[model samples]
Target: MLPSIIIVNYKSSRLILDCLHSIYRQGQEEFEVIVVDNSDDEEGRKAISGSYPVVKWIRMEYNAGFARANNAGIRAATGDIILLLNPDTLVEDNAIAECAARLRSSEYVAAGVQLLNTDRSPQITGNYFMTGGLNHLMALPAVGRLIRWLGYRLKVKKTNVASAEGLVEVDWINGAFLMVKRTAIDKAGLLDEDFFLYAEEIEWCSRLRRIGKLCVYGDLHTLHLQGESANDAFGSSGKGYYNLSDRKGYQIMLSGLVRIRKQFGAGWFIFHLAAYLFTVPVYLLVTIIRTLFLQPGRKREWANWWGFSVNVLRICGFVPVILSKKPHFYKVL
Candidate 1:
């Protein structure tokens, strides 16, 4: 039997239905698909329940956020392999088959796939490690472009028709189209519920990587539309990260890094914190002006900056707490 593909949806009613139809277009029955809807209401629930009968659907009365929503589906999954896919992506024929086949063949690999933009442009292929030290970078538009440039020069994204040949280890594959083994997902535990939106994949894959290897099959590809980017539980105005989401993502990553550093004694946590502070002015300006990403108005973006700054202050408040009181900060095992 094939793995059960889990798609977490919110406000993606039509897209979810269409995505399910496309998956069937692959003409493969080895896999099952489970869709978890975190729509604020049951409109999507009611509409899809009677309409789509091919798969299992879970309608959540309250929004459970992104990672938690997927965790819900993961727990219900029965496939030896578990595919965490986005609802907006259009899977080309054989995409799912190839990803599953490649991952199954590799003991070290947790997941792998080729992700493309809506326009068929190659998005990052293969996995990557999310760095926490001074050199670790968040792939914002600027950083994304830089990484792509480096990838193109290195010819590392995708090389040939060999689906699994090019990459061996990655920080993390884009959650947009990740295929993992059931054993790996179970070993890694489930997706961390702490991440309501961004960086959850990085955190999840980071743990899986500790166990074995993670990569992407760049030679094959799936089409991800620009409009349907994130399958988030909560909503994004796109102006920037909301106050609550920003606070959660930042603290989640910081908390992870602190735990890791205390064990390794990396001292890079201080360097990373310094980087975040320096980035404060830059990201603050980015948030305030809404320079590049077309989202909300400038005023809305500034509010996001103000929100992030508030969280940073709160995080500083806890540094002494973790150091003096909790003392369990470094214990990863």
Candidate 2:
């Protein structure tokens, strides 16, 4: 049997329906679809169920966030392989089968496909998880370029490929379309609920990596309406051509801090916090300059820095709570 596909829906009924149709049409009778609705509304539930009656719909009592919502579906899944798919993605022809075939291999613990944008251009293949120190410094654009140059000259930098002809081992694949073997899940346990969003997948894969190889197959591709659901969290204003809205951006930053605290230690969080604080003033000046002379796209870099500066304060002792409701507020998606 093929893998059980679990999609967490959050106010994307139309997108989810299109996603399901693509999967059903491409794979024929090879897979089962499980929809975990975090929209927390009967209207969405009714519409989805009424349209796709055969789907095994799991209505969440309330918005369970990404990690918990996916876990709910994982627990309910009966297949040997579990595919955590985003509701805003379309599985291309043979893509599902190809991913399942890769997961069936005993060598791979988890696998993901090449993600394409709406225009069918390639997007991020995958990324190495934040390991602190130099890796943390790599987040700074100019510093990152210098470090990459130095590492490449020293022949110590790891290669990241977006157009590989075959499966290649990677640090971690994006959560938008990840497939995992039942053995790996059993060994690694379920996704951590502490991470309401963002680095949840990175944390899970960090554990899974201990079991076996985690990789992305360049031969298989899928279309992702990137950040579609995430936009809803910040509302219409979040629709900037670049940069996330203040709320969404801060949530991601705060979640990264939480992930660091979980994966590394308090020391790592403090180190990154210091880095954030040091750069805030510098970026503030840059934001002003860009806003004055550069195009609108450049303004996003400004927003990112400004947002990070504020989040640093929140993380340090300035604010008692990151989100007023925090984990629960984050769950509303």
Q: Pick the candidate with the highest lDDT.
A: 2
Lowest lDDT block of 10, candidate 1? 233-242
Model 1 segments beyond 4 Å from truth? Answer: 130-168, 226-270, 281-333
Those runs of model 2 whose alpha carbons end farther than 4 Å from true positions after fitting are 133-159, 236-245, 288-306, 317-333
Task: Give all TM-scores, in the order shown.
Answer: 0.70, 0.85
What is candidate 1's lDDT per residue for 4-97, written digit by digit as tens? Answer: 8988777887787787777776667677788888765467766666766667887676666667788889888888888888878778767787
Candidate 2 C-alpha lDDT tens digits along 122-151: 877666753563454545433345666787
TM for candidate 1 is 0.70
The local distance difference test score of model 1 is 0.62
Question: Ten residues in a row with the worst lDDT in model 2?
Answer: 323-332
Candidate 2, position 187, lDDT: 96
Q: What is the lDDT of candidate 2?
A: 0.74
Q: How many clashes in each candidate?
A: 8, 0
Q: On a 0 to 100 scale, what is the lDDT of residue 316 in model 1?
A: 64
